[model samples]
Target: MPDENTDSLRPPPPTGWRRRIARAPLLLFRAGLGPLLGRRLLLLHHTGRVSGQDRRVVLEVVAYEPDSPAWTVASGFGAGADWYRNLGADPKTVLQFGNRHHAVTARFLSAEDGAAIMEEYGARRPRTARRLCAFMGLPSDGSASALRRAGRAIPFVRLESDPPRRLESDPPRPFV
Candidate 1:
């Protein structure tokens, strides 16, 4: 794959018929249901590598590593993928999950480390990681062991959930 700059993996799919078809579902989803369900969708926002502007993507969180509580993102097309490239350049990003926003820092990890974490997720959860890997066409290996050295195979993030939003004032205090 091309280096970070010249990489063809980021942005949209490679220009062609297959590319159009490949991304049709995402387009349809965003057009039809994105607005109604945006708050419920788990979204990630990453800056454009070239434009230096923000870009948002709806993603399904596959697994959260225990002990460390690191989030794992399977880079289906590997480091050459657009999201991966963006994170490589800038690890800082944001995530919208469960009607909440989080400031996050992302880091890539080795295949072994990713696989181990994947294993843990698959073992504990119901095919969240396995399904995601299969959907992304990533190798589903070692997906029950704890991640040993997560450093670029997968993009994992550390997140701080944004504080709750308050609107109306609290009700009158009850007698004690």
Candidate 2:
């Protein structure tokens, strides 16, 4: 939309106060208050590719399927983001949404699939979509084509979990 280089549009990883603010949600997830944030966000437990140490980050959910218990998330900061790259190195990981933790594996989606998902997300949440596009330095006009373009440029990951097993303490409800 901006005619600028796509790479230039991508934001660098946050630092200083911005990094601290961006990571604040992780504290909530760690404190078992993730449910308070609802299904719109999820906590990802990933491993550092080089360090081989566990890492955690909270990401926004772009699409979710209750039946398959899958959550689709976009790397708004582009593929260079540490979490995204780590997943590329090793897709097997864990995802925590709300109060439920799932043993999930990451599946990278095709550009076409990402386009479709972003379009659907824009339709469902126009304001949020526009904001996300703007944040990613994409067009924030909220048009289907613009959102689809943004989707194509960004990387999307689908976290698929094992078949749901009901636990005694867990309520009979779908995991978002």
- lDDT digits (tens) for residues 9-125 of candidate 1: 323344788767655545645455444454323566789899999876655455644344345555545466667678778887876554445667776555555556555656665
Please name the candidate that would achieve the greatest TM-score relative to the true structure. Answer: 2
Model 1 lDDT, full chain set: 0.54
- lDDT, residue 40, candidate 2: 91
In the range 43-74, model 2's lDDT, one tens digit per residue, is 99999999999999999998889989899998
Tell me the TM-score of each prediction against the true structure: 0.54, 0.87
For model 1 the local lDDT of residue 29 reads 51
Error of 2 at 9 (Å): 2.2
